[model samples]
Target: MNRILLQLAGLFSALSLSAFGGGKVVLPSMHQAAVGEYHWMTSQQFVDLFSISMAAPGPSMMVVTLVGLKACMPYGTVAAILGALVATFAMFVPSSVLVYFAGNWWDHWKESPWRHAVMDAIMPISTGLILAATWIISKTSIHTVPTAILGVIALLLMLFTKINPVLMMAAAGAISWVFLS
Candidate 1:
């Protein structure tokens, strides 16, 4: 009981620190660990939770809370709730402090010669991580032809147009309901 909770705490806390761009950027590794290594949830369940987090009002990192609850489900709802809270706190707190201080330091160092070099060096890595996350999500969610088409269209729209993402998402939902369902 205590062991499981502690493990959940440790996993999310470590993941939080690695979230360079945002929570979404960490999804690929998080997915690998939660689904492949830990056996906390299925690939489908993970995608579903990710969708829920995306649709929710807050940051997509809320997926950690759902993951924690799902992982602790066998123990009991109380255990699950505790897992959710612990994971959420672990995911949010420490990295936030780092960001706060780092942001200040970055502004102070804005004129440093190595500042641009360091940021430039890390740009590719950050972009690669985000692309990896996209691949993982697309691989999991594109089980159907319509879905694949929809994703392509959404990507094209995102790339080419000035459309609001919310509207595009709603359009995709409507199209899916009309055609896929």
Candidate 2:
């Protein structure tokens, strides 16, 4: 239990620091660590957790807490709670501190040409990371033909339409419940 808790702390802390744009940017790495390296959960379980975290009101990075809970579940309830707390703290604190300091520095350099150049470079990098995360999640979630179709439709809607995403998500859920269930 101690070993697992420490591992969770280390993993989340590292991931939090590297989360350039947001939690979504580190999804691929999180998936790899939790599903591939640690075997804390299956790929499907990671995807399910990701969906839950996204649907929840708080930060999407709450997936780290879920992962820690799942990882420590075999130990017992107390351990699970501890794991969740440790992971959440480790995941949020360090990056938050960095952001605080970096934000101040960024403001200080508001008119610097290098700041603008760096921001421009980050845009493409962040986009690439987000695309990789999307690909990884889609690969795990879209196994069946109907699911694939639904995903494509959702993508198109997101790209081209002004429809509310929550509505689209609810509609997709209903469609899946009716047709795919």
Predicted structure with the largest lDDT when compared to the true one? 2
Give the TM-score (vs. native) of candidate 1: 0.90
Q: Which 10-residue window of candidate 1 scores lowest in summed lDDT?
A: 52-61
Error of 1 at 90 (Å): 1.3
TM-score of each: 0.90, 0.93
Per-residue accuracy of model 2 over 84-111 as CA lDDT, tens digit each? 9998999999999997888878876887
TM-score of 2: 0.93
Per-model lDDT: 0.86, 0.90
Clashes of 2: 0
Superposed by TM-score, candidate 1 places the C-alpha of residue 88 at a distance from the truth, in angstroms, of 1.3
- In candidate 1, residue 66 scores what lDDT? 93
Model 1 error, position 124 (Å): 0.4
